[model samples]
Target: MSFPENKLTVRSSADLATAVPYLIGFHPADGSIVVIACRDRRIVFAARDDLPAPGTPAHHLRELTAHLIPVVQRQQPITDLMIVGYGTKEHIDPALRVIDDAFTATGLAVRELLRVTESRIFSLTCSNPACCPPQGTPVDPTTSLIAVHATVAGLVARPDRAAVASRFTSVDSTGDVIRHATTEATARKAALETAGSTAVFEAGVHAVRSALRQHDNDTPLTDDEVAWLTVLLTHRPVRDLAVDLTQPHDQHVTFWAEITRRADQALVPAPATVLALTAWRCGDGVLAVMAAERALQVDPNYPLAHLLLQALHAGLPPSAFEQATTSTHPNPSIPNPNTPSEQE
Candidate 1:
C-alpha cells in the first residue's frame, strides 16, 4: 500500500524495513539506516541493528564503481554531456574521471565534457530556539545557509522556485519538508542527492545476494531491477574475465571491454593500483600498460605500477620488471642529467 505524501505512514515503515533487504548493498549495521534503491525505486531502512560497522570510503567506492556505475550506464549512458552537482570539491575529481569513463564507453562525446558543479553543504541548523532567528552574526555554517535561504532566496527566488516546483512533481513528505538540513533525514536524501548527484544508489545487497543464491529467484520483481541485480552481483559481463578477477559467477565480457576500452595511460593517475585492478578485471595487456604509464605520469615513483611495467617488459612476473624500471628511473639523489624526468 502506498502512503500519502507528508506523513510517514507508521504501518508502512515495517513493510518497508522488511522489503529493504531487497534493495541496496548494505549488509546491515547497528546504527545506520540508508536509502537502498533497486533499479529506480528506493526502500528506507536501518541496518539489522546487529551487524558490524558500515563499509569504508574506499571500499564503498570500489563496490560502487564496480557495481553501481555499470547499472546506471546501462540505462542513462550519457557522459560527455553531463550536468552533475555533488557532495563537495574533494570527491569531484576522481569521481568525474570515473564518470568520464562510464559515459565515454557508451560512445558519448567524453573528449569534451560540459557543465559540472557542486554546492558546499550537507546539513543546516539554527542557533536560537526560533527556527527563524532575528538577523545577526552567525557562528555556525549551517546557520549561515539557513539565513541565506531565508533572507535572500525567500525574498527573491520564492516565486521563481514556485514555477520550477510546478514543473516537477511535488513528492515532498512532512519528513522531507519539516526536516532541517542538519537532520539525518535531510542529509540522507535531498542533500545527498544534490551533493552526489553524479552517482545514484541502486540495488540492495540484502536482496541481490539472496537472488544470486539461485536462478529464477524472484520472478515477480520488475525485470529492470532484476537485470541490475544480476549485473551488480556478478560484476563480469564475461565469465572468463570474472574468473580471472576471481569472481566465480557469470560469463559476460562486455563489462571487461567497457572498462578496459578507456585505458589510454595518458589520462590515468599515478601508481596505478586502481588501474591495475581495472586492467586485471578487464584482462587487456595493452590497456594495462597504458594505465601503468598513466600512473607514472602522475608520479614516476609509483612502485607498484613500476613493478607491473617491469613484469610486462620481461614477459614475466618477478624482480625482473621491477629491476628494469628501477635502473631506468633510478634513485634520483646524486642525479644523472641525461636521464630526464618529468621536469625535463
Candidate 2:
C-alpha cells in the first residue's frame, strides 16, 4: 500500500531504517527482505518477504526476481530501489547479492543496500566511517523526524504481520450462533429460490443495506438475521451489489471484518472477498492477503478474490482503487432501491 504524499525525507541510513516499518505498515521480523520502490525519492510502494531459506536453488532466486520486476514496473517506472536485509551478515549477504544481480540485469538502479539488526543498522554502500561506521550505528525509530510526522498524520506501525491478521480471528461464543444462523439462512434461501433470481437479488440488497445501517446504529443483529443476510449475499449479483453499495473506511472495515469472521466459509465467498477488498482499500496489505487466502480456500476459482490477490501481490497502491471508484462514480451514500440494479 502507498502512503499519502506525506514528505518523509530520508537523509541518512538511520532515517531509512526508521521509515521501513512505516512504509510497509509493520515492523518486519528477522530474516525479512524489504524492497522500497521510489520515483524521485517519493516512495511508490514497499514490499516485504522472508529471506529464502539457506540452500535454496538458483532457480528460486530467478523466479523471485522475475516476479518483483513486473510488480515494480506496473505501479510506475522505478527510478531507484532501496533494498534492506533484516538479518545477520552471513544470512543477508547471499540474498542481497541475488537481489542486486537480478535488479542489475533488469537495468533498475540500486540506490542503496543496508542491513538491520536488533540494535543497529549498517550501510553496505557507504564506506565513509564518519557517517556510516564500519561496525554499525544505533537506530532509534522513536527519535526520528519521520516518526513524528507519521504520528501527526495518524499513521500506525503494527508490531508484525501476525498482529494484523489476528484482527480477523473468530470468537468461540459464535459457534452456536453461527450454526443457528446457517439453518435459518438455508431455509430462507429455499424460499427465495422459489421466487426466482430477481427477487433474491432485491431481498439481498435490502437486507445488506439494513444490516449496514444496524451496524452503524450499534444495534446488534439477531443470530437468525445474520444467517439470512449471510446466505443471501452469496449470490454473485447480490455480492456485487453489496460491493457497489458500500464505501471503504474504518467503520466499514470493522463491519466487514466481523462479518467475515462470522460467516461460514463453506456457505459463501462474499464475506471473505469483501473483507479482502476492504482491507486492501484501507492499505492493510497483510490483512488483505490473509482475507484473500481465506476466500480462495473457500472457492479456489473465485474471480474477485483471485483478482484482488494479483493486485495485492503486484503492490498496486490503495489510492489506485480509491481514485478509480470515485472518479467515475458519485458519492458513496446508500443506494436507492427503486433505481435500476448495477448488477443483474
Candidate 3:
C-alpha cells in the first residue's frame, strides 16, 4: 500500500485492525489471510493470501507458509509478526494453528492472531476478556483513524482484490475501426523500419510523452496518431524509450494501461510490461499480476514480464526494485581525519 511516510501509532488490536486494509490497499475478502511483520513497533511489510480450505492437507498449509516466509525474510528483519484471517472462527482455526506452528518452527514470535468477520474482531492471543471481549469487539473499519488519515492523503483502497484486477482488463473491441487501425499500423511499421532506428526511437519517445500529457488534460489521441505510435513502439529500443518517458505514479499507469488496451496485443508486450511495473509500483499487486499475464500471453519469453511475475510471486516490495535501480553509484573515497601524517 502507498502510505504516508509518517507512522501512525497502533497501540491496540483495534488499531491494527483499522490499519490492515490501508496497509494492503484493499479490504480482504473472506478466506483471506493477512500477515504483518513489524520491527520496533512499526510495520515493515504486510502480505495477504487466500487461506486454504478447512479440509486441506498439511502440505497446503506448508505451501502457504513458504509463500509468506520468503517475503518476511527478504525485505528487512522483523521482531514481531501478526496474522489476521478474515472468516468465521470455525473455518479459519485450523489454518491459524498451522500458521502458528510454522512460525514457531522458524523461531519468529507470533505476537497476535486475530479473526475478523463482517462486524467484529476475535483475538486469539489475548486471554483477558476485559481487554478483548469473549464475544469479540464490535468495530467498524471505515471509521478508523488510519482510514480517515488515508482519505486525507488521497490514498483510496479498492473495495476488494477483484476490483483491483479489473483495472488491467484489455479492451477486446474487435470492430471494423480497430481492425483497420491495426492493419494501418502494421503497414506503417515497414516504412518506420526504413525511417532509421534513431529517428524512430526519438519520435516514439516524443509521441508517448505527448500522448500522456494529452491524456492528463483529457485530450484523446487521434486514430492516426495512435496507429503511428503503436507501430513505432513495436521496436524494442523504441519501446524502452517510451517506458523511460512515462511520467510518475498513476499517470504512468494510465498511459501504459490505455496503450495496452488500444495497441494490438500480439505486437506490443512493451506497454503491457510498463503497465505491470507501474501497477506494481503503486502497490496494486493484483493489477500487476494481470498485466504481466497479458504480456506473457503475447510473448511467453519476454524477460521483463517474467521478472515481474517472479517478483509478485516472491512478494518483493516495489521499493526493492527502486533501490536496486539506484544502488549502483560509485561511492567517493573519504580522507582519514585521524591520519597523523596528514595532521602534521
Candidate 4:
C-alpha cells in the first residue's frame, strides 16, 4: 500500500516500526515478515508473509525466497527496502538472513533489517548501544506521530489480519432469509430464461443498476433483491457489467462486501471477485487477497478471481487496470445464453 508522502515519513527505526501496520492495514502476526519497497524514498509497495519455521529445510526457504523475490522485483526501480521481522531474533534471523541474502544477490540494497517484538524494535545492522540499545528501543504506536498522521489520512490499522478478513465473513442471522429469497429468485430466473437471452440480459442489467443505487443511498437491499441480483450476477455479461461499474472507493468496497456475504454459496464467486478488485483498487492489498481467497474457496475454477490472484502475486499496481476501466462501455454487450460455454 502507498501512503500520501506529505502525510507520513520514516526517519528512524521507531518511525518505521510505527508505520508498518498502517502500510499493510494490520498488525503483523508474531511470525510474519513485512517487506516494504521504496523508490526515491517513497513507499511504492508493501507485502507481508509468514516467516518459515525455525527448522524449515533449505528447499523450503528457497521456495519462500522464490515466492517473495518476484513480488519485489515486479516493483521495478526500487532503490532500497526495509525488512522488518516480527518475533524474537532466534525465530526471525534464520528466514531474515535467507531473504537478505536473496535481495543482496539481486543487487538491491537492504536499507534496514530489524527484528520487532511486542515491546521494542532492534536494528540488526547497528551495534552501537548508544543508538541501537542491546535491550532494543521501545515502541508504542498509540503515541506515535506516524500513527496519528496515518489515521488523519484515512488509513486504518486493524488489530490483526484476522480482523481484516472478518469483514467478509458471512452473516449467520441472514441465512434463513436469504435462502428463502434464493428459492423465489431461482424460480423467477428460470422464467426469464424462457423469455430468451435479451430479456434475461435486460433484467440482469436493471438489477445491477438498482442494487448499486440502493447501496449508494445507504438503503439496505431486501433479501429478495439481494437474492435476485446474486443469481443474475452468475451470468457472464451481467458480472462484467458489475465489474465495469465498480469504482475505487470505500463505498464500492462496502457494497460488494455486503453482496458477497449475503449471496448464496453457489453465487459468491462473482461478487467476491468484484470485492477483490474493488479492494485492490483502493490500495488495500490485505482485503483484496482475503476477498479473492474467499471467492476461490467457493469456486476453484473462477476465472476473474484467478486473474486477480495472479495480478496481485505479480505485484501489479492498481493502475494496471486503468485502460480497461476507462474504455469500459456503460452498457456491456449482450451474451448469447445459447452459446456453449466453459466455466463463467
lDDT of each: 0.32, 0.77, 0.73, 0.84
Ranking by lDDT: 4, 2, 3, 1
Off by over 4 Å in 2: 1-3, 6-9, 217-222, 316-344
Best first by TM-score, ranked: 4, 2, 3, 1
Of 2 and 3, the candidate ranking higher by lDDT = 2
Clashing pairs in 3: none
Q: Tens digits of per-residue lDDT for model 1 on 1-344?
A: 22122122222222333222222212222222221212222211111111112343555545444443343433332322321212233444454455456545655443222111221212112244343233422233233332243234222122222332222112333323223321332234344345442221222222332332233342333333333332332221121122223221212222322222222222123213333434433333333455566567666876666767665433343234435545775533322323323322
Q: What is the TM-score of each candidate against the true structure?
A: 0.19, 0.85, 0.83, 0.91
Please provide, for model 4 over 1-344, each residue's C-alpha lDDT reduced to its tens digit, 9 standing for 90 to 100: 23544358777899888998888989898999999898877888888998777777788778877888888998988889889999878888777888999989988888888999887999888899998998999999889988998888778889997788778778567788898899899899999999897777788777887788789999999889999999988887788777766778889898999899888888889999889999999888889989999999999999778878888887888777545444643343743434422322
RMSD of 2: 4.5
Q: What is the lDDT of residue 181 in candidate 4?
A: 93
Candidate 4, residue 66: the lDDT equals: 85
Question: Mind giving the per-residue lDDT tens digits that candidate 2 earns over 1-344?
Answer: 22446666777788888888877778998889888888877777777887777678878767877787777777676688889999888888777888887887888888888999887998877899999898899999878887887777666678988766666656546777788779878888889899888778778877888888799999887767777888888777777667766667767777877787777657546887887888777766777888888788879998778877877887777677546545754444435645754543
Whole-model lDDT, model 3 = 0.73
Q: Clash pairs of candidate 4? A: none
- How far is each candidate from the true structure, as Cα RMSD in Å? 26.3, 4.5, 8.7, 5.1
Q: How does model 2 fare in lDDT? A: 0.77
User: Candidate 3 residues 9-122, lDDT tens each?
Assistant: 676787778778777778888899998887766787788889887777878889988878877777567788899999988888678888887887888889999988777888
Residue 11 lDDT (model 2):
79
